[model samples]
Target: MDDLFAPSDVSWTPVSPKLAAVRRVNAAIIFGVLAIVALIALGMSLGWTYGVLGLLVVAGGFAWAWVLIGRNQRSWKYAEREDELLVSHGIMFRQLVVVPYGRMQFVDVAAGPLERAFGIATVELHTATPATDAKIPGLHPDEASRLRDRLSALGQAQAWGL
Candidate 1:
């Protein structure tokens, strides 16, 4: 069954390990808040009936966090082709965004504190539509820069209709 859906010629690269950690960090923050609420609920269930209401609060928090963390991690994936960039990601929804070499306007390499700690960077590709920003996250800093350069050159050539 796995062979039926696999691409015969395409090479699949997994997301960076640091990206997994980043996703986990997001989950931890949410779960941590829910843990606090759950504790409060336990306190109330003992004798303070008012604390029973805290269960709903904790449950709601858990649900919300579950949705956020679970959904985001599930829908994130990407691939770089010879002439185009493919990004697939979303939370609670799946999106496959393709940016052709010709439509790419610019590529940016950015790093934040968390990414820096992981020694990873993000490569963002901007197109004519400001709202449609495509990004490849969790790249090594050097790889991100090289991709940026290559994408930039291809975008320029494409802009000239070459």
Candidate 2:
């Protein structure tokens, strides 16, 4: 089963560990706000009992999601092969996507505000078939730029019309 998802020959490059930290922080911020709102709203309208319960429930949800986010981050990996790029991720239901350079139409690099603050970016490869397109996130900005250029060059070299 492990072999099924493992890269063929090239080594797998795991996303930066900082990815987990960033995601956890995002989760914490969202959950924290929800907890605060729940505490205030429930306390004001439904009494302190429900307020306390709501806070507890939200806290538990954050804890659960925090662990899963770490696991999911650890699962993300990518590898560049001679002809294709391989991206694999997910914990419960794993997925592996292979995008051939010849079939690539273009490449894009994107970084959200939080991602930019964290100095990380995502590289996405577009193909004629949307199903074969793939994105690798949590890469350093420099790495993402390098990948985008490399993929664009490769795609042009191996150009296969739509």
Candidate 3:
């Protein structure tokens, strides 16, 4: 049915460009590690006729990770309304998750060493499921805190039926 494939009835907003930059940095670091491992494997496989296959496998891994990073940078979206907050992302398999304000347990604004270097913060929404959580990254630290405060307040108000 069309409904099965159609996008959900949810508004979406793109993450800040700064977020993409941060993700790219992370991807580069991961790719560098993979390259090193691949080189080591290639050296070990030399003269065994498996070097070519190893190289190909490593190249494919790099390509796959690169594509995944690109998709993550492109597909991430966030939206919040009085009733709920939504985060949607993924390239190969799209995902859209909605969290009602009334169901939110807490909100946290966090900045890791890398994000701090880029003047960015991540807002995490704590709900019942740790797996199906919400994270909005690449916000200015102040902005992240403000959003956290607003969302927490909204959730509290909603709980009280205000």
List per-candidate RMSD values in Å: 4.7, 1.5, 3.3
Count clashing residue pairs in model 1.
Answer: 0
lDDT of 1 by residue, 1-162 (tens): 333333344565445667766766666677667667666766756654545556566667657665565556545566667777767766435566778888887788888887788788889889889667798887788888888998899888877975
Alpha-carbon TM-score of each model against the true structure? 0.67, 0.94, 0.76
- Candidate 3 structure quality by residue, lDDT tens digits, 1-162: 323423457556677677777877887787677766666777686643565566567667767776667667777777776588877767668776777898788998888888899899989898877765788877778778888998999889887863
Tell how far residue 44 is off in model 2, in angstroms.
1.8
Shift in Å, residue 95, candidate 1? 2.2
Question: Which scores greater on lDDT, model 1 or model 3?
Answer: 3
Q: Per model, how many backbone clashes are there? A: 0, 0, 0
- The lDDT of each candidate is 0.71, 0.92, 0.75
lDDT for model 3, please. Answer: 0.75
Sort order, lDDT high to low: 2, 3, 1
Indicate which candidate wins on TM-score.
2
Best by lDDT: 2
